[model samples]
Target: MSGSRNPRTAVVTGASTGIGEEYARKLAERGYALVLVARRAEAIERLAAELSERHGIDARTLPADLTDDADLAQVEERLSADGTGDDAPIDLLINNAGRGEGGTFTKMDPDTIDAMLSLNVRAVLRLARAVLPAQIARREAGEHGAPLGVINVASVAGELTVNPHGSVYGGSKKFVTLWSESVALEVAKHGVHVTVVLPGYVRTDMTRDVQDKGLPDFAWIPKERIVRDSLRAWAGGRTKVVPGAQYKAADNLLRVIPRSVFKSVARRFG
Candidate 1:
């Protein structure tokens, strides 16, 4: 997708901060016109101005809370819109808007659970669905321009066998991981790419509480690295990317560890 001939545009949810902000900067650096989406209108507008000034790219702001049906539908409509005249086709989508609550499922509030499901599951699925059909059609018609792709931001928490404190968050991300890989397989032949990114303890507002908990330095990954690695993976036509070597090793260990062992550990620590 990088360095391709077509005028590339990307719609990035949660683009006001953290991983999503990093993605917007990196993509702008790569010459992609951006539609930055987030709930905070002021923040995204500020970012759009900064990115536009710095990169000289067309950076537009779309302030929408993805959990709201009306707002989410607006974003979906933008993704599904045709590229006519100045409105270029969105060649990339970054599904990065999500929320997580740390608690057992039974103890979590009903509204919180619904919000998590709506943003992490429903929003991701719908946004991807919105962007794919046009991409597939362009490919089938033999327009070999810039590649069309979607990058989903999941978490290492999803890969854990037992996450008592974040069961709902982990489960939501697990859905993202599974669904992204499945869609990657389904869309590959049509020249569309889907890549899921799993990160551990990134330095973001979302992880500020965990950062305050004093985890080892090695456990944390920079948001820039996550965006960089994810885009590289997507450009290379890879299905999944786990950023940070420590997390990569941990992901490998988790896959091999016994579920019974994790269950015992969860019982002791949960």
Candidate 2:
């Protein structure tokens, strides 16, 4: 169900499915006009129409593979455009496009590694850079929300010694987590927020295929809860958010563990 109409808008990458889809749903529920980005044009357009019809809000689809340089640039350009001038300024950006590749850092295919970096890291930074100027400008103009923000859908793997299975993936997310925190501080004085959400095992199509990657049934949380918890933390001014109580504890544990020990543990059990 939709909430009262809001003049604000949001751009959500990877909005066709999984956590990204949930973000689209929840943001639409709160009345934000949406720009949904994903690789499948038909899929995203259908989602857009459903959201628009359900919520009485604008929902447009921009289909692009985040790994393609040209495609990535288009998404950024659209964000910059929607973030300024007459249309409802893009009040939120959910940088949720990512690739979860299987295999250890060493055994991973080079092409897959490259694709992961392009989508999981480069696209996120480029898109954020494009939209932030406008988001900050609007907030400084005494916008009621004060700070327009970007939510980077990072992973719990970012903070762990997640090798063997997800080393490169974890490394890329580590970049996202740190980058969000750094930019979050840089924009804090201007009331612009940046949140990096580290979610644990979430039951999405991606995870279903990677069930043997050490995620247990008990640890798996539904996709909806992850998105909901993340939005709450972001809106409540948190710079970093871990959605699950179990993952929250794990994140804390990783904080004090030494790199050597982490590596040892990863090799033996993970």
The regions of model 1 sitting more than 4 angstroms off are: 1-5
lDDT of 2 by residue, 103-216 (tens): 866777899999999889999999999889877766565565434789999898778775433878889999999999999999878878899998888877777666766766
Worst 10 residues of 1 by lDDT: 1-10
The whole-model C-alpha lDDT of candidate 1 against the native structure comes to: 0.89
In model 1, residue pairs whose N, Cα or C atoms come closer than 3 Å (at least 3 residues apart or on different chains), thus clashing, are none
TM-score between candidate 2 and the true structure: 0.91
Give the CA lDDT, 0 to 100, for residue 89 in model 2: 60
Residue 158 lDDT in candidate 2: 76
lDDT of 1 at 239: 99
User: Which 10-residue window of candidate 2 scores lowest in summed lDDT?
Assistant: 1-10
